[model samples]
Target: MSRSYRTVHIRDFHDDDLDGIVVLWEAVHNAVIRPVYSLAEVIASCQEDHAVVAVDGDQVVGAAVGRAAHAQGWVVFFGVSAADADGQIAADLLDALERRMAPLGLAKLSVLVAEHDGRVAALAGNGFGMRHTLRYLERPMPVQRRELDVLGDVGGRILPRHLWEAVAGMSAEKRLLEERLVTPLAHPELAERFGVMPPRAVMLFGPPGTGKTTFAKAVASRLGWPFVELFPSRLGDTAGGMAAALRATFERIGSLEHAVVFIDEVEEIASRRRGDPPSPTQGVTNELLKLVADFRDGSGRLLICATNFVRALDAAFLRHGRFDYVIPIGLPDAAARAAIWGRYVPASVDIDLADLVDRSDGLTPADIEYAARRASQEALARALRTDGGDAEPLGLADYVDALAATRATVSDESARDFLADIEAYGRL
Candidate 1:
């Protein structure tokens, strides 16, 4: 039986496939294959250098040759047979080659493809940024610098650039933040013309699983500022207790040129005070109030505080002058749920998204994400257990099943209370 060349499998080149590889090179390049490497040289490359081939049964249809030196690497040779010029085969060959070379800690991998080569499109599709003929392409590796010290001092971390875009939906909330917080910080001059002083601090209030923390990080990312999450619990064990640690953290934050300090579940330390023998956290709350006042006086910084129960917070904490805006991040609406669902489910899968979205009413973003993941996991397990037949794609039925078994993180009562809180306290 003739070997089928349809199912391309990418693997390391073998000694026995020399003739097929040579034929593939000749067939693809034709006149361009001048001074081709000898069989001995090719064999040596396969044995020593990073090399991979796309094969179908016994036939070699594509090859990629890569070599790494010090902190740099180069794709020296890449060719695919004319008969098998599909972009998928070329992409597979490149994928295999890159996987083999990635562990070498090479700083950069470059390929010099001809201007008119059809493979250029394929390379671009695989994340190879283009450069003009006269210009050189360069990408600098991220290096940790002294500026990051402030983040460490305050128990903070830098968020990735994509986090802002990764926030699936919440158009109204995102827009409000962008206008009330992001716009003033990003374009101060424009804000000044509108009599808008850049926001110094804001409060994010909602139910537990409503993505308040994620929104805080996203805000920092959008402004290209460092994210410093002050953990009150972690500070409680410090030398001076939570109040002293909180003061010291702010002092350290004051040193940085720019920052977005976040404190999640802030009500823990800033809860309403009672008469006579005040709460143990009263002193801590007083210290925090002073810190917020001091922090607001400084420029180039924004403080974000998140709370599950806004009513539990001290009235002074939510006063008009203290917090510029008190935004509410509630459960995902139908449109928001659809967007979140789209993010978790593979686009290739055929499912009734509208039905799923309708069924996911009152679900938080975290809840939807968990349900979608569960559906995917269940589908994957079923596919693995199947013996021979092509596995069925995860459909609406699978997701519905997962949804039935998944517990909603936020209960209806909690959601109603959150709505009430927003009505009573929401500012933006």
Candidate 2:
């Protein structure tokens, strides 16, 4: 039933849909998420929202996200891409949610939506009345990191160390799972159940810095697969032109046997074409869909797509048989965070590694590394002040101050929330 319904039925929300969700959010909302509403906020909404996506074979044509609230409180965060922002998707999300919330006595359902938009009208058409408008806040300040250029190549397509690092710490049972990453050979049981399934699209969706890209890189590196990363801009100048580009992408990917073809922030290439004008990259989605089916067609390349916003995606890309696995990278846990922190802290520094890791809540590995370096620099500066200062080692104060100074840059609160979100949504 689930597989048959993939043609029109709504599927669940996933991290691979992140890029799509973000695009629609940025496009229609005329807004940006940060400071006030971090990526964790989105994950938290998803926590309660029984997000459903509408799929047709290998193409995701529509999507909706909604959940029940107390006293039939409300359902929010529902929208479909490039179309009237309506409850078409909402109704579907709400139907599933109502059942989930029914035991809790979910009564009248509601949604927070744009007043004039068709979606709002559609929700209203579906029995939701206008509610008081709440301002979606935005921060006037610059993004804290000041280093927004995450696009810079981070060690070109090498096997990332962390996945293997994670395996090193896991038990033997987990090692078997990690083995899947190293060897493209799917486990016989899993292969029978999912590997040989009709479509073989792999979706990687999550907030930035959950190591989505790094994990894929690590997997490719571990498997000794040649990796290729593509972007929306690669789709060519015009619609027909884009189709050709899309064809070329897979054609190139197809040639790599037992190789990994990674599409980072893939939703840009995979969004559905609704009533809205098509972006240059529109055709790429359809093309990729066909390419994914080729997995069953016998081209042995691993297809991986990653995005930060999954809600905006077309559902076809998420159909079970298409991608053997759909994974969302959650934020690092306390142990992972502590380990990241420990790596950045030099053995030369005389500080409690445990205390440092405990305090680093929502930090990504990169963030932890940045903070550790600053702390070390500060410690070195302080040591220079004493007569024998050069002989003195860096202390906890340096690490603490280093962390404190960047506190607002990447708030501790944000870190915790992000961590929690990942733990809840992370597939691994």
Query: Which regions in candidate 2 have their CA more than 4 angstroms from the true location?
Result: 1-163, 166-199, 234-242, 383-392, 407-428
lDDT of 1 by residue, 1-428 (tens): 01223687788878787788677655645444442343545556777888888787788888888878799987767788666555777777887888889999988888766545666777888878887764334432222366676667676676786777887778888889899999999899999999999999999999989889989999998887888888888989999789999998899889888889999999999999896898899999999999999999999899999999899999999998899999999887777888899889898997788999999998888888889999999989889888656888788888999899889888889988988998999998
Q: What is candidate 2's local distance difference test score?
A: 0.57
**What C-alpha lDDT do the candidate models reach, one value each?**
0.83, 0.57
lDDT of 2 by residue, 1-428 (tens): 12233235566766676665555445445433222333444555665555555554544445554555567645545555553243455555445555544666766666554435556655666666665756555433211232222212211243443454552221332343355444434343565565543223467766666667777776665555455676656555646676676675566445444456677877776775564586655566777777678655664457778877665576777665677656656566676776677667777666777787777665666667778899888766767777564454777877777777664333556555545644543343
Off by over 4 Å in 1: 1-146, 384-393
Local error of candidate 2 at residue 191 (angstroms): 4.9
| Candidate 1 CA-lDDT value | 0.83
Model 2 alpha-carbon miss at residue 171, Å: 8.1
lDDT of 1 at 293: 94
